[model samples]
Target: MSRHLLLGVALLAALHSAYAGGKVLMLLQSEKNIDRFSSFTDALTAAGFTIEIKGYKDSSLKLREYGTWLYDDLVLFAPKAEGFGGSIDQQTILDFVDSGHNVLLGVNSDVSEAMRNLAAEFGVDLDDRGTKVYDHFHYAVKEDGKQDHTLIAATDLVDSPVMVGGPYKQPILFRGLAASVPSNSELATVVLSAPGTAYSHDPKKSMIEPPALMVGAAASLVTAVQARNNARMVVAGSVEMFSNDIFNSQVTVNGASTATANKDFCVTLTRWAFQDRGVLVASNLRHHLLGSEEQPWGYRVNDDVEFLVDVMEHEGGVAKPYKADDIQLEFIMLNPYVRVPLQHDGQGTFSLRFKVPDVYGVFKYFIDYSHRGYSYIKLTHQVPVRPFKHDEYERFLVCAYPYYASAASVMAAFFALGFFFLYHK
Candidate 1:
């Protein structure tokens, strides 16, 4: 009986895992060969995702059914499609992301205007329609002793482990257009940028212009955006990078040949875009007296208070304690009264003990944490801080002793005067 019960429990667990895996809607072009991305699709399948492949021009495609999103993620692989068919337009894509769903958008040299506008919304500026990124010095060498400068061997990856499971040992092979992300953009970040020798221009034309539209390291090959709502989007310059050929290709840099890291990078990029990694959630926010577990209705000025919160990061559908050294807590009114770093117990419980500010008013406990490649956590808890009661004031203030002495002298003088008057009478 025990064995049967265990089997039933295991079956239920399997069902739960299957359902928890998200559904993805991949929009591709009928002309583009889907089999080329088998490796990428297989990886997603291994990660327990259900993929629904549809042509971008499929008029029956519906992202929403009865005002509800039917898919957890969207993949745009049809760069040449002028516009999505049916109800899926640029605004539809934006609304999907605005609703906190993830997107992985890919574009090529033939990128369409609709795709460009979508990328623009995410702060990714793609090069002109016919322009392709060319790296004269970093082009992949063909067996015929010719180099196609458009096929760039990009090694300038963003220095973020949470973003691109990094420390890439080899260059990623890219063949497509280039994009430019604003250096000062807070929402968008460059995941892979063209090498210093690379530039974006018309590959069919000669060099008459000195500065290309996107020159050298400024030409971003891949970018990722983490929206304020924590919706993630990754824009790839070359959709071919996710193909099996690139995944299995070898690149010769200098005198040595090594396998391309496109497969690993693409997998990591998709995982991040889908929120399977670097997703943080903060909960159990609590603040109270230093030694008390129960929170008071309100705090008193100058009270030693402790604030605690549980921070967890989701990976492979499992929540684990989030580890970081920079999470901070702020006690705020109009401005921050106290801002201090939160210390974690290695078990996800972050705590900070601070004295409430002497200023008494309605104050809020605020936490605003934004990390590159990670979900943004913004939390605010409002609480009032009361001043001391009149009876709670100190009995004998040193500053008031002079006044007390003066009053005492006045009373003594009156009594002495009264005694003199009575004796004389």
Candidate 2:
């Protein structure tokens, strides 16, 4: 019946709705394969997302119509389309990412100039001549000594729980040929690579000069870009790598003669690409003195303060947050004055309590927490530390106070003796 109570109830409902809602949109070119699109859509949906697939050929489709807000996420599976069917062109897609939304670009051996241009925009150089990757030493071998270089098996994956599947039961090995450059961009992180034995070339023709790009030294298979704005993008050299057939296929690597399923690798790669595994989120951040209820505007020299942050996976389940030993903190000015490991409280909180240094100046509590499969967490809280106040100084030093009293008494004695001597004389 009260207006204030009604307002409070309305605010709670709005908060809940915002937290519980999210959508995924897929934009495809006319020639895009139905199977690949369907598989990706199904995976996202199974992950509890509401997905909508649209074709660029649709007459009503226009990137400008949506302006800066087309979709929360975009999937570009139509690499061969010379241009988008909608008003959305290459520039429009770039703008979408610039505005902070996720994008997935899947390029196969049949990479087009348009696809290469897009990859270049993201600082990736796909071999223009359509070179297939070949690894004689690491390729899948048959009964004969010759290697099956076409369907090469790669297991030299980046040892990142976030990039690869978490603690794979068996090694995730893939038998396919894809080309990528070495991990070079400061903004991008490489997830998969061709083994040291692998190299890219025109597999149809015989070698002329030593291959242009060497394996292990100059190629990547799968690379992920996490922009400064936290917009995520995955660039893969092969699209069929995520197909149901490849996902379910099994292979053997090295001396393991028996062939096993390669489904694990496919599943792991998909999870990493679709934002499944490595999703670090900031839970709680706080700063306060050791024994006070109040959080001060600044700290005092040698004051003990506790810095805490709770990190957890974004997906809901029974997963635990960062363990007691899994977090770290930095007391930084320009560089870190102190880089200390945080102890967890056994609950969800990872915290560190340390005394402020006697030095006084502007300093920041910084935590750059990036786990392998999670989103990166960066936090900085600035607070200045002042020299101790006069009243706050230690009281009545035994040695110094005695010295002060003796000096005062000596002065009084000299004055009294002078007065007496003058009067007596």
Candidate 3:
């Protein structure tokens, strides 16, 4: 009986651990051994996540066979999925994130066309087959004193402490590939960039001329995308960036020895990718007449109106006010008739005051607040704008008084002429 009780307690402890850590589904493109991904999962485990490994061809990836809800988050480290033999289509992964889950995707050398297609759907692109980002000037030297330009050190991690956390402003090691983001495409942000001297091409071949595009800082070594549902996705150009070897390896750049910042980067990135940070929400919404307690029946063309909203950010499972410099309010009809900035009062209160637009119609009070490395906040309130009521109009019109007097005089003259004609006759 004592032994049985001990076993029961152990089972309960295991269950508690799994529940506390949060189940994560990690998918590999190839069915080969997964020893390479241990360090990647280790980083996440440190962040309180339990990683579940599976191959892309596994029966469990089927849309009907398995659902994305089985896990809290996903880490897809499939760089070479040519056919990706599974019932799980590209849309299945998107649907998973659309339901408010998060995903982290990594790509390495020999990027497959199938991966490119999937990335394109998410507004990101991967490099062609066998292409890697080679920086002859800034490549790190291996421990054996061999110089490989393909292995680079990137520092252009875009300015977002909330995502990068500590150990930011340091160089991260990259070993493979790069991508190009369209100048106007806003779905993805370049989190890490290759240096200006770097050009992406096959390292084996001698190039007569540099590649046309996907060069220099424009070549994105890593990017982060936040879906419309606030489901975050991180696309990395190199899978080895999250590997144990790279994390522990020392790098020599320009004959100076330094430790790689990849370990810290991997931890912070895992936190951000899984929604541990950079989450924001808005609440306590209030809007009414500028100086009155009662809500107006409707807003006139020239009415003083005030708008208020309480915005807070999510961190460490707590929501706190996110102080920011730019929060805007737009009074919209078919198009924006008025656009004004909201002022924060050192707390979470974002307050704004503006006269109602002269035009009267169905207007929406639109608050679109978005910044890099933060959750998006979009709030809208529908309100009707109306013309002045009959009683609300001015009692007297000075501009029309002269016209009114002239009309009265004309009537009097015509009546008197008719009276004269009748009497004389």
TM-score of each: 0.92, 0.81, 0.81
Residue-level lDDT tens digits of model 2 in 1-425: 79999999997577444333245666565535566546545766675556667775665655445355745666676656566665777887788778766677877667778888888788677765457777766665444555566556655566776566545444434433354554445767667777777777776677877666656636777777877666677787766566565554444457655442345554455555545555565665888999875778999989888887777654322235655365679998777878998887766688788999888899998888665556677888899989989999878788698888999999999999999999996
307-422, model 1: which lDDT tens digit per residue? 99999887767778998999989999999999999999999999999999999999999999997878999999999999999998899999999999999999999999999999
Decide which is better by TM-score, 1 or 3.
1
- Model 2 spans > 4 angstroms off: 1-22, 27-32, 36-40, 54-65, 140-148, 166-184, 204-206, 250-263, 316-320, 324-326, 332-337, 359-362, 399-406, 416-420
The TM-score, computed over Cα atoms with residue i paired to residue i, of candidate 1 is 0.92
lDDT at 381 for candidate 3? 85
Measured by lDDT, the strongest candidate is: 1
What does the lDDT read for residue 295 in candidate 2? 74
lDDT of 2: 0.66
The sequence of per-residue lDDT tens digits that candidate 3 reaches over residues 205-320 is 78898898878998999888888778888888898888778888887987889888998887787788787778777887777887786766679998998888888776655556
lDDT of candidate 1 vs native? 0.88
Q: Flag the better candidate by TM-score, 1 or 2.
A: 1
